[model samples]
Target: MSLSIGLVVHASRRGVFEEAVEPVSGVSLKWVTYGHERDIRPHVQSLVDGHALDGLLVGAVPYRACRDVLPRTLPVAVTRNSALDLALALGQAQARGWQAVPVSIDTFDHEVVCEVTESLHLDRTRVTCLPYADDQSVDEICAFHRRSLHDGDGYVITARTAVLRQSRGDLRVLNGSPTPSSIRSELRELLLRIRSERAGAAGFAAGVFCVSRHGCPGDPERSRMDLLHLLRATPELTDAWIENRGRRGVVVLGRRTLFERLSRDWLVAPVLDRAQESLNVPVSAGFGVGSSARTSVVLAERAAVRAESENRPCGYLMEDSGLVLGPIGPGGLGGPGGPGGRSAGQWTGPPTARPHREQGDRMRELARTVGLSPATLSRLAAIEHDVAGRAVTPSELADAMAVTDPSGRRLVRKLHAHGLVTSEGWAQTHRKGRPTGLYRLAIVAALTGSADGHALETV
Candidate 1:
């Protein structure tokens, strides 16, 4: 059967998005414009009374005021197509620490789920297409119970939950709503338990079912290079405060005032020096350093929140998060010359001190822990993958590390430090500006090497 979509929009609204609901070929649209509240309710009821729409799509984009007015008889699809599911799933994933399992609904293309999974860059193995079960009734739910315990594979089934619950004749129904950010974390927990057989004392459980009112937060996006720069600059920062309860991105840590004197803007210049030379979009950051004793998600959450709230729009934080952590310390981690005390080659202080603050030594451990070198990790930018989705061009590598050229002096220095390259001209200047003299790596591993293998240079 062909699908027809009806749009209820406001008189002032224009160019509404329908690609999410209408198929490329199968769906057609009809519209009704409402100048006020009275005009909408009757039209909505009229449509339902006449059975004019196979699917009702409503939202804030154009005429979203009608969303609440739509009748329940027809399958009402919200304008933000599957946003609720995505949010709930993402929240649940983060909360429960489950790995996102992208599943395809049988027969009909579950396009919404597919698009979301791709955008989220979920693992292909976790996503699959299963035969559609027409028996979407109480009977179908009973069958699902058996499937859950036999092999607790993370599955994304597109079926009504109330019906699925009714079908499970004897199994207990665990009900809840997952937040948006927690989905990734929840999936992680699920995968860990499955791999290690770390099932809890709640034995004989058939399976788990989560239904969320809010959808997934579009992506794990870190705006600009601000967060990355902040992380690299604050070498002493560590993880603290933890929010592993039932959410993903909510952790509190001991606060460190980054700018007790030198404000945020002034701090960004040298911090993202290399990256700014590459990407046109300037960035800023917010991060602190603590001991590497307890890897908590709290620090990451706090840093991220601060980056988003206090810093600029594109600002962000890449704190130790869960990667590096430690105990309560003496200075509270941020004071006059705390973690990111050394300002690149140029030093500013009461008494003259060396630029070499041994910050790289602490950073080396983080790079290695993530299975890469600090230099390699330092150059992480979103470059175009090769024709076959592999290989990083010299230019691409440079951009990741915020450099202008691959063989540039800065790149050469990073490569040399990691034993990936050798330099011929190493010039030192008494001037307090930028370093000069160009060089090259011993061998270019630009295309052949894995991104995970190399650590990014300090942003």
Candidate 2:
């Protein structure tokens, strides 16, 4: 089926997006105009109420304003300003003998502006940067622009279309014009996410579980009813059906996407975990994904067995190939790992020894959070150790991982997707080709039992 997307843009910027969607097939764009950038939530809501949109593409200003207000489950993409954008505007001004001019920017990252200036080899001190915070009023923004002008600043740049209208002086609206290629790229990325979600919804997943009634004894029938009640508490399990609820175990069938959501631990676990605590019992769940019902059920049973062997209160997943993954179920004990698990008979990672200690357990937990395999976690650990407290060049990472440049780039991109790494900056060996990307691990600092009283790690 063709996907229908809604493009929420300012009235003035609609032409570029209209042109970008002309060449693409199997997708349609509905351009919805908003009078002001901040007043976009209502317009988007109206579009959603009237049309069955598969996704949304919005301008940068409106996207930031409406991000927290709109439903996050709805797929949305926003345009971004590139270094080239700044250079283009600056290049035009430079031709007229304009130099040492203060520039004002709104709705763009300050760090990015600095990086762009440094990358282009522009004199940093000559241009005084004025960036707008989200809470700044229109009047305040205009006042700053006026002050810059009164102070003998040569130029004023802004992303908001309305800001330019308020200025009496000939102010340059830093259009940060959305290129056709960039808009197409954002649309393609959103489409891929939508397709993945749809596939997960259609796929099958099974859960085999047993309620432990050790200290607090209760009737078998009552326990079964309680378990059913707990499962019903979560809306994700609404479509789930109980296959069996006998003395052997309880088996439930549902969409694999629901399993993935519940497996996140923070999402649907608290309801079940809290119920178990109140009932003075423990629940173990084994989740399985497979092509056929019989396969899923068998894998679920094996996963339950694995959970029991590990002495875990939560459940596990047993791959068809006899590999075990998880401590997934209740009480926040969920995690991800399975070194032997192969997808389509391919080795996703090189073999490594499983960690049994605290650091190893922590690494495995972080890996699960980001949906990476245990093998990748091991590789990350090695790379982090090799370059302690330093960023790794893309070429260095590619060499260390023993993969081609493209494969290495994909791996780094995945890490960035999970916010475990970021582009530190760009570096130039000689002013020849494009500058290489310098990447540094993004550390999440939390209180730990370390001697320094803080442990820095990537999740």
Candidate number achieving the greatest TM-score relative to the actual structure: 2
Q: Candidate 1 residues 1-459, lDDT tens each?
A: 445556565554323233223223444556666665457777776666665665554432222334455543334432222334554555555566655553323211223334445567666445543322333343454455446433554543333334334533544232222222222232233233222221211111110001111222222122222333333344322332322222212222333332211222112223233222232222322333333213223333344344434222122223331221111111112233654343344323211111111223334432332224334543331222222233333444465556676233234333333344333332345375222332333222332244332222232
TM for candidate 1 is 0.20
Weakest 10 consecutive residues, lDDT, candidate 2?
Answer: 347-356
User: Considering summed lDDT, which 10 consecutive residues are worst modelled in model 1?
Assistant: 204-213
Clashes of 2: 0
| lDDT (Cα, tens digit) per residue for candidate 2, span 1-459 | 899888887777778777777787888777778887656887777777888888788765676566665553566665655445666766766776766356665544444466567767766565544443446677788777766666655676565677767763556545545567777776777777677656645778788776654433676556766767667666777878874557636788887767767655212244335545555455666777666677888778776666556443466654442234454435332223432222353212111111112333454444433434445655665466567647776667789879876556556655654446666876775677545567875532211233222232221
Q: What do the candidate models score in CA lDDT, each in turn?
A: 0.35, 0.60
Error of 2 at 50 (Å): 1.1
The CA root-mean-square deviation of candidate 2, after full C-alpha superposition on the true structure, stands at: 12.2
